[model samples]
Target chain A: MPGVKKCLQEAMAIPGAIGASIVDYTTGFPVAMTGAAPNEDHEAAAAGTADVVQAAQSRSLFVSAVPHDLLEDLIITTAGGYHLLRLVPTDFDSRLVLYVWLDRLRGNLAVARRRMQTLAEQLVV
Target chain B: MTPAKSPGPGSLLTRVAGERRTGALVVGGTPGGTVYLAEGQVTYAESAAAPGVGELLTASGRLAARTWQAALDAGSAQASVGRLLLDQGHLTQGELELCVLGATYDAAYFALAAGTAAFHEGVRHWLGDVVSIDAAALNRESGRRIRLLNEIIANPRIDTAAVIPVPRPPRERVTLTAAQWELLVHADGQRTPADLAQLLGRAGFATIQELRRLAALGLIEQPKARATDNPDFVRLPRMRGASAPAHRHAAPESPAAGVSIDLSIDVPLDGDPTRAAVPAAVATSAPPVSTSGDPPAERPRLDRRKPGAKLPKEIAAEPPQPHPGTDEVLLKRIRTALRALR
Candidate 1:
């Protein structure tokens, strides 16, 4: 059961991880952040991440017809990096998103993605 | 907008943080809230206008009332209730921290508004701190929330007014979040957003925000907007009665009783979330007016429904038929998604 600080530290330790932050998508602000950010401004990165999460959650364009099939994670790959957003599932309205930025050359997408899943689960239950 | 006159003493949070003090700043107003700081960083906050951490937990069924009571009794003395819950395995660290963050931002939004504040040194919140936030960051976040809300719809009075569904909604169909759906279904003409917030065990700010969203979508009646002659009864989804819910124009006035039963019992509190997710059928009935063609003197024109009424299960159980345009929209999305995959 990692506390919030421990969770962020663990996320930073992931191979090739450049930055990690837990954002309250509802409010569009980062609750806790660690390591380096995309623009050297975690605040801007947090806002950008929130816009994508909000669009995915609210728009039918991204939502599936399959009942109970909620969005799990999204991977936004760039020329040099991968931005992964894992939606934290809670019973109530936390609307938290665990976001990690990774360097494409150094990080294995499969490993980083899987590590985030474990981290997200451990962050809660 | 704050009055241009008598300048209120600004938030003490910044000054306190500068001194690295630990205490609470109680903002005074009609619906004021308190912000708790540990070493000048915000650890927790609670507003009378919003549900606190405990209510959020019990209302969501994450923690039972008795369990909360037990936690309170055990940890109240040390101001370590939050830690006690975590140690007892009642809630995880992330759950506690995020919830604290949610409650803190929400309370601080209001606390920052009621400009007058006085700081008491060394006071701590009973829900021991999980994470701390910078005073500037908290202020920035609150400002962002206020701006975002106004960007959606600018009426602050909507927070306190009775949420009456219009007799005729503007859109043929509107999408609602599960939270929005729950709010509309339970909205009695009498319950304000704050009242509904406590009943639902949701954050008051969240309720206000969703109401603003509903107002933006033109789903619920806007405060002091021209009277649609909205009857006291809720216009539940028009599936059950003889009335035509899909009538693009107002259906000829059916007795309000024909379409909706005035909620007699408090809709079983959080009795069924799956049921709450089902949107209320859009009702399009003519305004209930006296045969005299003039509105009644006493506005509660709708018939008083018998006590012990539950929204007919069929109204919620039957899935709405997909609108013809929806399939096309879905297909377009699929095409776009598939092309991206390729």
Candidate 2:
């Protein structure tokens, strides 16, 4: 199944993957989640990802100066893990955000970002 | 409304899941629905209020109506329509699953509402299972949707009442989502959100959310504001002790509820839409022709709500000579400023 659940399963397969979740940032709701969480709670982690994504889209400090340009993704680095959030763009209101927690020392940030971009694309169709 | 001994649909589903049961839980209500679970995970749900996955797919132009019907006829009997759609290449694996996911959650939101439920053993949804939502997540999401709707507009009346757009919005420019624009275009001040949802072939609850958002932004007429028929009538807040109706309108009571909605928007003040949401009156200036049931002569508004301030043009327009109520706008501001100081 080339779907969100399957995509999340694939996200966990990425080396050093801790946890994964798909969130609707518009209301800070998690569409589906899997794997480990920063606080050992997927809902809380999903909510935090939504907040960061919301800020990136609305706040001038994080928003780009380009006209009508949308944000691609956001990554928060901690000593132990890397929290990656990739936005899913759709024809309709696509406030859907994808988040994956990665072990900092074991995971490759570049590889994780590329994999998430692919996962985000799978969600739209 | 008393199902005191009976478990709600939410808890029923939880119990079903705990037992690893497979069947359909039918919720009987005005617009009742059914939840199809596989081994306790919610595989699909359908509500009378919302368009099902088939309707959602066809309405969005992704799948043809004939194709959907064909798939249904082919796989509905064995409860494998989802697999048939994928096998027939009518919908991709991702499309089928995502649609099922969205439709399941959307329907479950309404299905889990206050209703009596009965479990039919071994019954199945024609669409079959694609993606499943655990009972906990399903409960949380539904609860969140309810909270989000109430948070958008405190008054419950707007959800059930007819959606009526203000005849003449006080603002010069207004922003709205495309879905909201469509709902407004179709609003006849007669059809409620549920009615509009079926008419538009959109998600039922999503339309309700949009309507509430529109009301919060003052784009649609509030149920209480319907009394003052004329949008141009600036129905000032009645003086506290004045002979206003003893029954308070639910809309204004929103802020007085101790929990304030952060209506202090961060967007620019220019062309703000919240202006029309001011208490009862939506007009920026005094009605030259007071078509309202209550004439300006006796029920003149003395308060200036920041919501209805047409500052830029009012400064350049002719003086307020015809309507005496316009002058009180300044006085009300001064009074408010004084109160703020204290």
- DockQ of model 1, rounded to 2 decimals: 0.42
**DockQ metric for all predictions:** 0.42, 0.37
Best by lDDT: 1
TM-score of 1: 0.73
Largest TM-score belongs to which candidate?
A: 1
* Residue B287 shift from truth in candidate 1, angstroms: 19
TM-score of chain B of each: 0.63, 0.64
Residue runs of model 2 more than 4 Å from their true location after superposition:
A55-71, A78-80, A90-95, A123-125, B1-5, B170-173, B198-202, B224-342
Give the number of the best model, judged by DockQ.
Answer: 1
Residue clash pairs of candidate 1: B237-B281
lDDT of 2 by residue, A56-108 (tens): 76566766677767789999898988988998765322357788899998999
DockQ of 2: 0.37
What is the lDDT, from 0 to 100, of the residue B38 in candidate 2? Answer: 87
